[model samples]
Target: MSENRKSKVGSSAAVGNVGKKARNFKPTMKKLISYLSDYKLSLVIVLIFAVVSTIFSIVGPKILGHATTKLFKGVMAKISGTGNIDFNYIGKIILLLVVLYVISALFGYIQGWIMSGISMKVTYKFRKDISEKINRMPLGYFDRTNHGEVLSRVTNDVDTLSQTLNQSLGQIITSVTMVIGVLIMMISISWQMTLVALCVIPVSMGLITVIVKYSQKYFKQQQDYLGHLNGHVEEMYGGHIVMKAFNGEEKSVHKFNKMNGQLFGSAWKSQFLSGIMMPMINFVGNLGYVGICILGGWLAVKRTIEVGDIQAFIQYVRSFTQPISQIANISNILQQTAASAERIFEFLEEEEEIPEVSNPVKLQNVNGSVEFKNVHFGYNTDKIIINDFSASIKPGQRIAIVGPTGAGKTTIIKLLMRFYDINDGSILIDGHDIRDFTRGDLRSIFGMVLQDTWLYNGSIKENIRYGRLDATDEEVVQAAKAAHVDGFVRTLPAGYNMILNEEASNVSQGQKQLLTIARAILANPKILILDEATSSVDTRTELKIQKAMDNLMKDRTSFIIAHRLSTIRDADLILVMDHGDIVEQGNHEELLKKNGIYANLYNSQFEVA
Candidate 1:
């Protein structure tokens, strides 16, 4: 397979396996816990409330058992004609139980409210950090990584952490508290019955362990395939037009069906295992119940334990088993949480771009005198694409770079903008190293119009104003008129106010190019870079764009990367590149007279035209 296809396939495979079991679960959990550190006081309060609520609930059955015992004795006394039943005592116990339950419910509500707030705050912080990290990240990261993969971390992974914190965190505390409280209550009633109940726990745990071990892989697979499926769908939707034009519907459908089938299998298996856990645990609890009942009955016959005690012990057993089951389920959920947290933390911890200097050079005025001295660069350092390239341009010069594909033409523009830094040597603007300025300050001085135009879903005026956010409506309209966009825009129903769709398909290619040109015009930067800016337009549109560009470049240092030699015949200087080196450099007329590399390239284009 071609390297590009291999990379795409590899990326797809990597996306599917991204949610597999975390490599370092303990560390990931630790990192996740650190996010909650800021809310430690609130979490402590929530913990206290959770414990108190559980204690209240746990003590209820035991307290109610006392009433059962009291009523039983009263009935026995009444039947024997010894004494009257204690109605007032029973009434007091019932009222006390009601009060305890109400208090428990209130505490539970408070804790839930606090926990939810903490979870939301943490989620907000997570998303905020991711957004900031995206800005600081290098462009190479995006080039190598899939867009959907990054999006998954922002959306899916963060959501998983959020939901788990909101729901499972409270559940874990409550379940642990319930289990401990219930066990104590059971033992207080009768140790023999408690021992019998405890016997079944090992069996239940053994079954739970086995089920979790087997289901863990399926759960991982399910999550993995879910990401893969989502990424595939997004990719197909984004490129649906091209795919359809190339008649790739069958292939797309086949891939979708294959992935969907794997997802279905994994989902079904994971859910089935998770579902059976409750039933299996419940069955074990029932077996323990039978054993406890027999032991309690024997003890009661010997008057060693009361009937009421037996009733409470059974309730305790039910309570004990329930929390155990909950804890088991929660364990699986925690695994998924760890995986999600790991992905998010991994992204946040990625290497950012080189830090800006503590004290940066502030330019009083940008004269647009750009010089590249002994420049060496490569996307990969070991295989340099630009080998010791050097160039110099005076202020307000229109320098055109003409090169064959892969001759590092676009790389020069990127280096000038500092999208990627040069490996060696200095890129200076007005004799100050570009690295001396902050990335934002350095980038702000340059305006770019590329072959591929980017405009978001917004009105034409809003899109134009994106170049200079503070630009007035009048300024925007002037820019549009300068770029020859006003005439075409006015013919539309909503004119400048017409909202572009998500893909901006409402406008033709030429119109899109025009809008981008207008955006550049509004920026009014010191230096302008045009990469095949008029490539998409027709003869008439190209002429109009050329006129606008000529006016735009009149007082600015401009760099143009063009394939058509005829268009740049009037350039101040043309640097003809072959391979990675600038083989010839001169004005078009001078190079044509030299009959060198530039001459041959110009002659070919002229003949083709």
Candidate 2:
């Protein structure tokens, strides 16, 4: 497999390695907060409302306890027949309790609305920044990285950040507020009871710490194996045809079963461990409750505290424990958020393409003359591929580059397009360094058609018009006819209007090549490049394309990278390359007469045929 494909497979297997802990939690969170700085005012409002809402909720049970005490006293008085029960006083307490809860609900709803908007706005900004960053990133980065890895940052990581912001942010504020407020209420009622409730926390926390520590590794394993399983399945499905041809179904199934069994084992263990936490903590809390109730009854018998105080303390105890659990859960969620935020920040901070010159030269008319003067380059600086290469082509000349595989043929094209910058020397066009002109202007002078044809999901006419967006329907058809695509397109239903599927698999490979050729023809560029462009089509169709290309090459500088020597026999100049240097250069017949590398390469093709 190619290095790029290997990187993709490795990336897929490691994708689920996320959702664990962040390497730099504090720094990641600090940077994430900087993004929210833009919405400081809104966040403040949310904070204030959240605190207010939680306070109201915290006070509700205490107020209701007063009503409970009033009712109890009235029953005692009526049974003793002492002065008649005060029904009106008890009714007033109940009414006050109802109003407090209703207002609490209203504030909670308003805060939730504002929090949701803030999270969505932050999500939009994250996506927009990532989108723009992708454009500015150097092509070298993509050459070494997996496309799926980049996509995961754009989709999965951003989504994780968004959900945490929308849901967990508010929960964090409320949970903390509840814990503090309920603790105060419990203390105010009875310090003794508050102390009893506080005892449950240490035990609960100890068990929780142990559970999380053990289950964390299982959770990570589950996610890791889940990624592996998904990657294996996707690879198998994508290459099912190749697998069947090789009759490797048994191997594929066995691999899948192995991964599936591992995923099941880890998933079950993680879930079971996580599932036991709540009941375990609740059992600990129940023991604390038992002690508090016994102490409360003794205190009431001695008349040291009101019945209402005991009831309110119990409510505060329940409220306190719940938020502690919520806070613990939110802590885990925050860790995941930090991990996601770190990935996004790392992408945004990556080295961008070399900055464009402030005053780049603009060419009004390109003459198509090009020269490579001692150009030195390497995908890696340590490993020079194209070393001190030099070549010159005049205006309107047909130049053919022929070499064995891995002879730096495609690297030459990539250098010309400025997809990568050369480490040494310079490439000149029209007597000016190519870098003097803006990359956009430099690339605009040339039209390229490569072996791997690219077509989007669009009607055939639209695909052709992509070469020249301003071209009218008549121009599109003329270009299509020139490339011999109009005939086959007309035979299909809907003709040029037919919508291509996402993969553009609806058309044959040769037809796809023809459409791309039609696109390049419509560009009407001053310089043209064809890299094994006719390899997909049969000889009969190739002849027609060659004729059309010949007409299009008139008065235009063209470069052809071909393996088949017979195809470029009529070139104005043929350059034979090997190991990143030109071994020979001349017309086809002149190179053949030399009986050197070019002659040997030409003879071998015919021998293979």
Best TM-score among the predictions, by candidate number:
1
lDDT of 2 by residue, 505-571 (tens): 8999899999999999999999999998898999999999999999999999999988878789999
- Assess candidate 1 and give its lDDT: 0.88
1-609 per-residue lDDT for model 1 (tens digits)? 111111333235564454355777799889988888999999999999999999999999998889998999999999999987899999999999999999999999999999999999999999999999999998878776766678878888889889998998999999999999999888888988888999998999999899987777776676667767777787888779899999999999998898888889988988899989999999999999899999999999999989889888888888999999999888878877877788799999999999999999899899999998989987778888788888999999999999777787888888889988889999999999999999999999999998888999999999999999999999999999999999999999999999999889999988999999999999998999999888888888888888989999998999998888878988998998876788889998899899997888777876854
lDDT winner among the candidates?
Answer: 1
Candidate 1 Cα deviation (angstroms), residue 530 = 0.4
Q: What does candidate 2 score on TM? A: 0.92
lDDT per prediction? 0.88, 0.85
Give the worst 10-residue stretch by lDDT in candidate 2: 1-10
lDDT against true structure, model 2: 0.85
TM-score of each: 0.96, 0.92
- Count of clashing residue pairs in every prediction: 0, 0
